[model samples]
Target chain A: MIDWLISGDRPRSVALGAVLLGILFSLAFAPFLFPGVRALDTAATILIFIVLVASYDLLLGYSGIVSFAHTMFFGLGAYGVALASIHMGPGWDALIVGALAGALSATVLAYAIGLFSLRVRAIFFAMITLAVASAVAVLVSQLFQLTGGEDGLTYRIPRALTPANRVGELFGVRINGRILAYYLLFFSCTALFLLLLRIVNSPFGRVLQSIRENDFRSEAIGYRVVAYRTAATCLSAAMAALAGSLYAIWLRYVGPDTTLSFEIMIDVLLMVVIGGMGTMYGAVIGATIFVLAQNYLQNLMGAASDATSALPLIPDLINPDRWLLWLGVLFVLSVYFFPTGIVGRLRAGR
Target chain B: MTQTLLETTDLTVRFGGHVAVDHVTCAFRAGELTAIVGPNGAGKTTYFNLISGQIGASAGSVRLLGQDITRMGVARRCAMGLGRAFQLTNLFPALSVLENVRLVIQARRGKGFNLFSIAASHVEMTTAALAVLERVKLGALRDQKVSELSHGNQRKLEVAMLIALDPQVYMFDEPTAGMSVDEAPVVLDLIAELKHDSDRTILLVEHKMDVIAKLADRIIVLHNGALVADGPPAEVIASDVVQKVYMGREIADV
Candidate 1:
């Protein structure tokens, strides 16, 4: 099993690298190590985004299908778990059932969307997904009685995952609910990432790449192009939904802004681009870099702003509040110079 | 009499005010190499597209092995043994040459939907794909990316993919469209070798008279979306109608 996990040169290295990164991130989140660092919650958020971005890459990078509706599926998964926990009363079993429900719903919805929209041209298909996703986002926000409107829904996870439940201690660190939740996110994300790696390396994945390169030729060669594409859509959606379920459990809440917002969709797209499209490792690297930047870069910029408050430059330009502006500039520069993403550049070097 | 393998009746396609493939009727007999010769915009490709189900016909019915397949899709036609190579070389550019051919072999072996197994680990598929590469004389370059190959080699790779399909009816639309003078004969010879099989029916669209002369058992001349002449090459070459419409003074002089 270990050998299989790190089989191919590039893929093996990538998988092993992901494992190492996961461990390092987990260690950073541990209470005993880096006690002054208060970024465990942020670290957990980055792990969830790894799963989400990788899932998105499965569609956009591997299959060459540009879908703006990915966040809708992500939102569905989160809401699924949230509603299930609220209705069934919080428990570990309820969380499992909710995750399953979310994944299933996302799969069904993806199938329908893929069937109807995949028949159209690529650009038209993208537009249709965008329109459908926007509509669903509005619908989720307006359903006050069930979805909690704009206020969102809050529910308890299993007691073991709550902050109040302290499991024990390990390596001079207290293993409480927060620590347990971090580890849970770590293992699940790693497993899902490996599964995606397996899928993209499989024969089915090869056909998807062929279709991506030339759909007409793929069809001409006797592959059912639409069916393969639809299958890819469903698989990617289910993975994204699973990530969303885990995300909701981690946050202990689900809301339109946090779950189904267009910003989340853009963030995923940015991650894929910055990490590199078509390389699975891009998702892992992209999410890590983006999340870290989103969390720490703002603080770093704020410190700079405090020291340079008397500068004659435009106040808005140097304002720490405009961290996103600096991030956007970095994103554009990365795309321009490293268009293939960080993984792509690394592969090219070797 | 040779059994009819494919038949097209009153096939027509109109682009609004223009008729691309006018009322045309034709038949491809089993075990014959038939070449469709025409000038640019003569609808040679549009005709291939209509019969191959690449485009919806304005009016016509296509029958393969005596079964009507006019409404069938491009993929269904391919599954039913109608293989087509595009005028422009179409292939998975990023994939290795062997992988490209293996995909076709995998499609034929009915393993396209197998998601669990690694594609390269399929011994049978790999062996068959390698055999095809050797036949096309692309064995040494099998590991090279398709994009790395020259235009002529890419054309051969395209034909190799068609060969992997082992289709009963083969359609080649300008297979040597952009090949160098020396490279054109390589593809022409490949077509001739396939034509040697009495069970295979080959329909090719060619501009080079030398290739058509060497391979065509019969010649069908299309001018402005209509069949103007059809017969043995010698007879068609002698026909004033073909000479006037297509062969012109230069081909006649040759």
Candidate 2:
């Protein structure tokens, strides 16, 4: 059965199987999962993280380019949706408009930065993106009146998914609660993931790989290196924006703290690196680890704090404040033990 | 009459104050084997770089089949029918030999944007790419990863890539630079076959005297970034300037 699942030539089949499994698992344990929040919230976090990480991998692992500003696109998408909800009606229009605005803004930034930085390779290109992101972060923080500065903004949204919806009925399930949101998020990820599979296997994707391997030889073959890289960057940004928009709707809030945080960047980086750079499913693995670990650590810490004087051992065992420190150690260990990342090591063994 | 495929008139490539390739004019005509010979610092490789559009020419113009291509990019020039094999082996090390050839095949087919089509779906291009590999006797190694191949095999793969493009003009920089005595003839034979049988317009920069003597229909000698001699092998090799350039002294015995 395991072999049957991964045996297909089409990457879509694998993605389909993975999505179906995730949906099934969530539905089976829906009652026990996040009682106050819907199953959809869980799905949303996974979907958003997966999309962000995969997009980051496409650029970093496949194209050999890094952008610190990638999270800026995610932030913009969330902000756009929040601002739209505050000003426009909730339904689907605000979501669409917000995503478009984020995409357009990211594409514009990608084109301008791509024009200059694409000529240089490796560290220089990485630094250029870091510089751009830092500058943008400063700019966002300075827009105090419009952006609500450090405090961030919150926007109201109508419920779009519940366990009793029509989508849930297809699976003999009800989406009247959070379970419906999980289905929506799962379906979106599956669809976008299928599209991503197509894009990665395409001729354009080969050119991107060729650029990664040898830019001069690819140029010799008549490919405009900059044009293609910029296209990938824009596509990656746009997909990330979609994910971000969904995130905003799921949380019903938006803030510069979410958009401009280095934590988001670290998560995306970790997803691509530890999960296995260049592989599409790396994002999913990375996101699962991150979200699950955060939830577990926070619960452990909360339990310890509640116990106060008696639970010194438990506090020491699950320190929430030291998560980043642990994460850094994990990254170093991953690099040392599996230099090619997880998937790369598996492929090499084969 | 056959046409000229590549013509460089007074081409000079200057880096700062130094002339790497100075005022070199040469025409590479179809069905002719042209050899460029020079010492280590003689700028022969630089001349190839200028013609291949790898570097900008500070003076003069390069024409491809009568179209002025002085400002054309390397990839554009390649599409216009210029193929170049580098002095160093530059095959895609991570890919299989066949995959590397398939990449060029896809480029030639201009199907670089087709996402839905599987790689195996490119039957005709794959067949042609395979045929080119077969021609270079690299067909047996097609399934092997390029990095796994020996240095000589890698060079053969590079030549195979050049051939797979079916370019109008083939530029080889030191085709046998790292080849052993036994491996040198394979390259010489390929060059001879390209000239005598396939009628390819060939421009090569080689240090191997025996290979040059065997294959060069016409030889042009370079010294200090300038062309010193251009003629048939015997006349160019016997010239006072050529002899002095190669031996660092006049040929007193001759």
Candidate 3:
């Protein structure tokens, strides 16, 4: 059954499988088990990012493409949902239309970028994506009336998805629309992740892997490298846009800072690298750990700093204000120790 | 004329002021094994690159069975039945040996785009890929990564990939350059086997005289970016141009 889900590409490491299962179970029961607002938000965010990070993995890890314009696609999806809700009013149709429009636009933009710049060297493509992403960021900030500008757009979704719509009780936990929204994100992300798994295990995915290994030889072997790259780019962009739509629906808001930020792009890159490049499961582990650490690590640091306030230098060094510093340290240590990312390390150890 | 499999008309490539391949016109007919020989820095590989669409021709054209493919991309040319192996082994080093060959077969068959189909579920394709691997004597190591294979085995794997591609025109650049004597015969034997088909054309670029003498039906010698001699192996080997240039005696033409 597991083989069917992943199309027979095993996780290959017992520890890795356990971690993935743990994440799956926790996500599946987060609303019931965690029973708090912040925890639910974090869980929902992780679910959304699982799709976002995994889609990025398909591009960077599977196809050897380094694209910085991922946030542009994500923002497009958010804005798509935002604009649809504002113009068309709160409903499922608006959400669907907005998501589709965002995905379509993102795919088209990716194809255009891929066709124009993929012919150049990898570094040049990276530069082009960076430039394009920056331009989109600038545009989103300047397009005030249309996009709500820097402040971003906040609007309604279906009433059933909001915290106000109580849907009774389940196992001592009050069931509400927010819980429904969380489950919606959960199931959609799982299905999407499985689809990505199927793709990476398919013949099409192997061609991308081969291209990543040696593109010059892939061309000689009759696989059009650029065409496959463009196709993967388009697919990845659409997936990311879908993830963004989910995020906007959950947050009930879309802003440049929330969706189109460079930090989010960096986070996606970090998650992919920390998870392992080619292994899709790495995305799950990576996003879970990175998001958890980002949210909770500072709290732990703050407590530690308070405890060590009696000591002069220690409190200042490990201060909660420097959570980013600690995060950087963690990233460096992971890269140094794991080298191939956590999943790669575990698989190698196995 | 035995259905010319590939032809080049004044095909040339230049890097700034340097002409890497200069106005090289040639043709390969069916059922013939043609060897391209040259002194160091002669444009033998460059000419192969031009023919295989690795590098575009600065001037002139390349045609496969009378269809002009000069502007075609590498994959397009391969799809149109042009198969080439590199002088240095080029392969998916991180993939298993079987997977490397299977991808070629998948691409050639145009089924590499099946997003939902499990690659292993294609039992017939796997069998076919394994058969090609067996022919190249890599069947035993099918599960091993290409990077783990010895240089000679990688070269054999390169041939296996080409065979799987099933192109009418086969371009091999120094196929046995790094193989041991025992390993060399396997590749030579496979080339000999490929030559058995009357519809196939083989082009080899090598510096070894004995291998050229043994396998090549005809020999073409290049002297510093230009085709200097073309004839049967015995005739070209005995010619003054090959004797002075290829044998490395001082020659002014280069």
Candidate 4:
């Protein structure tokens, strides 16, 4: 089964694995197998990031175009739903409309960016996107009325998704709105992940890979390089917007820091790089590992620091509040040991 | 009776006071294999680049089948049947040998925009790719990564990709550049075969005199970014100016 899953040129096995992983993650939130609210929440966050980073990989890994504007699209999606819910009143219908609105806006934004900046050199394109994204981040933070300013926006989700609605018991666990919300996230993320997998394995994807390898050759072979890159940017941004919408729904809040911040963009970059740049499976694995480590590793370090406080030198290095220092060490070690990222190493092992 | 397939009228490219391809006006006639020969920095490659639309001309126009394509982008020019092979062996290095050919085939077939269909499962593309690979005699190495192939085989693969494109005009820039003497003939033979199709046109830049003598019906020699020699191969070889600027005393002695 492992061979069947990992040994193919096509992405079907990887797509299947992603779907299965999504289902398992959703199941972890169930009461009987419950790992607690914090763990379940972390798992849900990981699933959402899987979608973000995988969509990101479509550009970074598949097309070899790096832009810092992904979180802008993501934030657009979150804000789309948040604003819609506040104005139109919270319900499933409004949420869907908001998600669609976000996706459309992101697609349009990406198309415009692609038109203006894609013709420049890659490094220049990156800088252009960075400048544009920073401006948008500042705009979102300063829009006191519409965006709720620096404090961010809080709005209602669908009644069915809120904790007040109990959907009945399942497997000795009382299934409620929160569980429904988890499953909702699971199914949507899985579907989006699968769709992206199919796209990257398609003829279009082949051309994107060709462009990445040799843009001049791809152009010489009759591929409109700029057009294809634009299409990829739009597709990646739209998917990211969808992930962002899900994030807004799950949290019942949309804040600049949580959605459009540069830190989130950096996190996605880290996920793709540590996961493996070119492999889609790398995104899934990378997000899971990174999110889990971010959530649990700090607490684990805190406990260790307390335990080792009497040990003098060890206490300083294992500082509880500075747990990210250890994670930084782990990240450096992983990059050194598995230079190609985890999925890259796994694929190489195969 | 052969018609002009491509013509560049006073095509000029200048880089900050340095003339790379200086006002080269040449025509590639259908059903002929024309060789552009010169010493290093003779602007043969730059001339090819100007015609292939890889770079814009500072001044001049390229007429392809009577259409002005000077300002056209590389992909559009290629779609209009202008194919090129790079001197540096540009290829999808990580892709399989088959995939490199298949992408060209796919591009020509107009399936490059198809996002929903699986590339590997496209039987038509695979069949076309395989046929081109077989023609180039690299069919046995189809599944191998291009990086794993020998430099000679990679050069052949580049030709195969162009063949799959089925361009009306082919621009070859040192297709045999890095090949051994023994391996050079294999590519020369493949290029020779293209001349049998009377409607196809070939523009080649080569340094090896033997290969030029064997294949090029006509030779256009460039010296300091200017065309100094243009005629049949034997006449061009015997031209005093060609010997002075490009051929040098060595080929004259021979």
Give me the candidate number with maximum DockQ: 3
Per-model TM-score on C-alpha atoms: 0.93, 0.88, 0.96, 0.94
Once fitted onto the true fold, the runs of candidate 4 whose alpha carbons sit more than 4 angstroms away are: A1-32, A303-316, B247-250
Report how closely model 1 matches the true complex, as a DockQ value. Answer: 0.65
Could you give candidate 1's per-residue lDDT for residues A1-350 as a string of tens digits? 65455323153355536655665555455456544325777778888898899999989999999999999999988998999999999988888999999999999999999999898888887998899999998898788899998999999888888879988888777778877787898789888887887788778888999999999999998988999999999999999999999999899999999999999999999999999898888887888889889888888887877787788775457678899889999999999999888887776755
Candidate 4 on B59-97: residue-level lDDT in tens?
989999989999999999999989998898899999999
Fnat: each model in turn: 0.70, 0.49, 0.90, 0.86
Comparing 1 with 3 on TM-score, the higher-scoring candidate is 3
Tens-digit per-residue lDDT, B19-117, candidate 2: 998898888888888889888899988898888888999999999999999998887898888988989888677778887888888887787767555
What order do candidates take by TM-score, descending? 3, 4, 1, 2
Q: Using lDDT, give the best candidate's number.
A: 3
Q: How many Å off is the CA of A118 in candidate 4?
A: 0.7
Deviation of model 2 at A148, angstroms: 3.5
Error of 2 at B74 (Å): 1.4
Model 2 DockQ, alpha carbons vs. true complex: 0.53
RMSD of each: 2.7, 4.1, 2.5, 2.8
Of 1 and 4, the candidate ahead on TM-score is 4
Residue B38, candidate 1: C-alpha displacement in angstroms? 1.8
Model 4 DockQ reads 0.68
The ten-residue window of minimal lDDT in model 4 chain A covers A2-11
| Interface RMSD against the true structure, candidate 4 | 2.0
Which stretches in model 2 have alpha-carbon errors above 4 Å? A1-40, A162-174, A298-322, B197-199, B248-254
The C-alpha lDDT values of all candidates are: 0.87, 0.75, 0.92, 0.87
- Regarding DockQ, does 1 or 4 come out ahead? 4
Residue A307, candidate 1: C-alpha displacement in angstroms? 7.5
